[model samples]
Target: MASNVNIEFRKLFINNEWVDSKSGKTFPVINPSTGESVADIQEADEADVNQAVQAAKKAFERKSTWTQMNASQRGELLIRLAHLIKDNVSIITELNTIDSGKPLTASIGEVLQGVSLLTYYAGLADKINGQTLLSDGPVFSYTRREPIGVCGLIVPWNFPISILCMKIGPALAAGCTLVIKPAEQTPLASLFIASLFKKAEFPAGVVNMVPGYGPTAGAAISNHMDIAKVSFTGSTEVGKLILKASADSNLKKVSLELGGKSPNIIFADADLDYAVEMAHQSIMYHSGQICCAGSRTYVHEDIYEEFVKRSVERAKKRVVGDGFDKKSESGPQVDEDSLKKILDLIESGKKEGAKLHCGGKRMDRSGYFVEPTVFSDVNENMRIGREEIFGPVQSIFKFKTIDEVIEKANNTHYGLAACVFTKDLETSLTVAHAIKAGTIWVNCVNYFSPQQPFGGYKQSGIGRELLVYNKILRLSLLYSLQIKTCKIILYCLTYSMKFCVYEMI
Candidate 1:
């Protein structure tokens, strides 16, 4: 862990105040690099979640400060919070790295991305507009968008700071108060940012943080009756459970950004070196904990052998050590369970007849570290190719033509994202259009922008994140108003309708 990194905010944050959990229980925050306890954070259970939701509900009342604030004012607060995050980038990066086992450089990049999201949403706050309609009657009609009251935001452990900003940016801009539940494994960064919310002068209870296990606090948020909507970023299995909780409770609106097994296709006409490096980084970044990591790579048969050779050498040379080390290219897995699952999946790949080109075993060290592993001769039937292996493990497959590769890429149940690397513009366009993923990167991988919307198709996810102007509208209610200035009544004779005349009064 970094010497300057301090865990200042440990308790639950509700209504702009830090307090202990109702259960008075705490959980250990471990440093993955050394596998030791760094701090014990206050655990939030169902009772704590209730308190947070109540606070948010109060803040969302019609007469509350958050409710009465103008769109520009809300935008200003987001901008202020963004500036505060920028002012303390160093400390926030350190806290994120220490809590999530991500490299310091990557953590810094995520923090800046978060700032960009906040700024983007701030700029869009006052720009949101509704529509006016013309009806067949003598009445004027127009639509007004209003907030949906309290919301529950569930943040995953990976890329904590950035994802938090991604959710809060639009939600706050749309005047929706929130009760946020940061993942238990990595809550320090979220809690630290909660302090900045107060510094930004956001109204009390507008944004709250409650850190605890998924079953307790997370479930409570999904099932809370007062919460009008829930936005979650995590696994597909858990996403289903959250949807069920919504149905079982208040039927709150739910948006999920779930798991993925993204495919990276490299054609023979492409720049082989760039494709190989991008594919490698796509999976190796943050130890491949990202949901949209390109775990499956399909190479043209003409360059398959050479690509595998280079990828294996690259994996072997990757430096796996503490995240704080300047020379380390990769860091430890988030925890022991994650390490074991990755290792188990690696073994399954071997058993399923995939050729292990290089690194396979776990790195013998103090913390939960695994070697960057690569496999070749992969097929769609193998577990490595079928499942979302959220680790630094690459599975490479060979393809003969564009049609076959596209079929292979779309074969997975998950369709979050995909990548195509080729010099031929026609081929690139064809593959990009043919793939069934939400985001298709042409000649690139893992590229993200705040202006672009990101989500998935099939079983990957339900809704998009970023490009939040319309998404924020989805979090609001639409009301149509019609006004009539004059009333006219028509009278008709019933006995002799054929010859009778109608009179207007």
Candidate 2:
């Protein structure tokens, strides 16, 4: 294998060793914050993915220490890794800022979020138990929540570390091995994080990361027959492609946390000042690259002009610059593609007749910067309202009644999250129930913990992550139970007996 690329990172972590890409191709990990190359990583193609999967398959099939170890022991190891992360928090923050071009504060918060997840799952590792159901016959039935073998997880360029922990901690805690495909743009921190696991002395092949493009490497992992589960976090179009790939292969279990154009609604009764502040944060956090960003804002018709003016002033005050800068409120989008997409949307919004309040132009200097832009008089049918821009721009609409606003918000295919700001409990409760998103925040925007589950209701995605209450639907295996003096209702090669049951919600 090639020695560690002194110019950059040399190897992709496979089977506990840093090995060069099978193809011997190398790519630079560019710092979007500075528009400079910071590190180099092996650019793995399909062949590299195959090697990673084979190692993961071997690790799982051999009943490796990761699978056979006691849950408590695994949890303890996870806690150790979490502590390791705590010590190197500043390094992680800097890496994330340089890698994905988001503010260092946001990256630091994400690193902490990841650490908390590891610690939380560490406590939960031994708690994943299968429950027994009271049966009528002399047959005992119970469910087993066993790990589903090698998991192929693909994380996005945004929020790399936190999402990585979300996928890694749960799967490992449940006794599964992994083959991760980090986004090609932002793979540095994950590589370092996985290296920390090596420092913590995890068994070989328990977790392998291959940094490569989505089409070849990611497809190779999804289409691997030995992979029993697939977990992905990305755009809506890509999520569907993953589903198709999973179905084309061994029909592995699939979980997706996809795109969103979430709504933030402000009733006239809301705290005006707080609403204005939240409205600014709803789209500007992480440069509005967040998947659950409240990109679409709705205000009551009575307070529309006031909300717009205050929101515009607040948007104007946002300082945009390099993420490493201490005083920067907003940073550039992740890379060039993200910046271009945001600019295109801004032009389209102006053409579609939505009045640009401020920040319609890109920054004249530096790497991949867009002004925190806002659009007003946005119609529900406009592209700005319907599309997921994934940038530092938000489209605002005005509505009169709670029911009407709910209808407008739910009209989109993406329903990842929604936020409502109101002091009246009755109106909040009524509006919260009606807003058809996976997560609804009352007087808050993007409040997530390691304990609370987050997903979507519509085309936003499939399956959830970080659910505290264990609702795993594990089906019981027949051979493990003892059946005695039970009615054998086997109708082989004939019509089966009819069964019917009624359930209430």
Any runs in candidate 2 off by more than 4 Å, and if so which? 1-10, 468-474, 478-505
Model 1, which residues run further than 4 Å from truth?
Answer: 474-505
Estimate the TM-score of every prediction: 0.93, 0.91
lDDT of each: 0.84, 0.80
Error of 1 at 5 (Å): 2.3
lDDT tens digits, residue span 1-505, model 1: 4647778999999999999999999999988888999899999989999999899988988899988899999999999999999999999988988898777877888888899989999998888777777777887767667666788999999878889999999899888899999988899888999999999999999999999999989998998888888999999999999999999999887888899999988899877777778788889878889898889999999999999999988888888888899888778889999989999999999999999987788888888888899999999998888988789999999999889999889998888988788777778778887888888877656666677687888888777787454444542233543322111111211212221000110
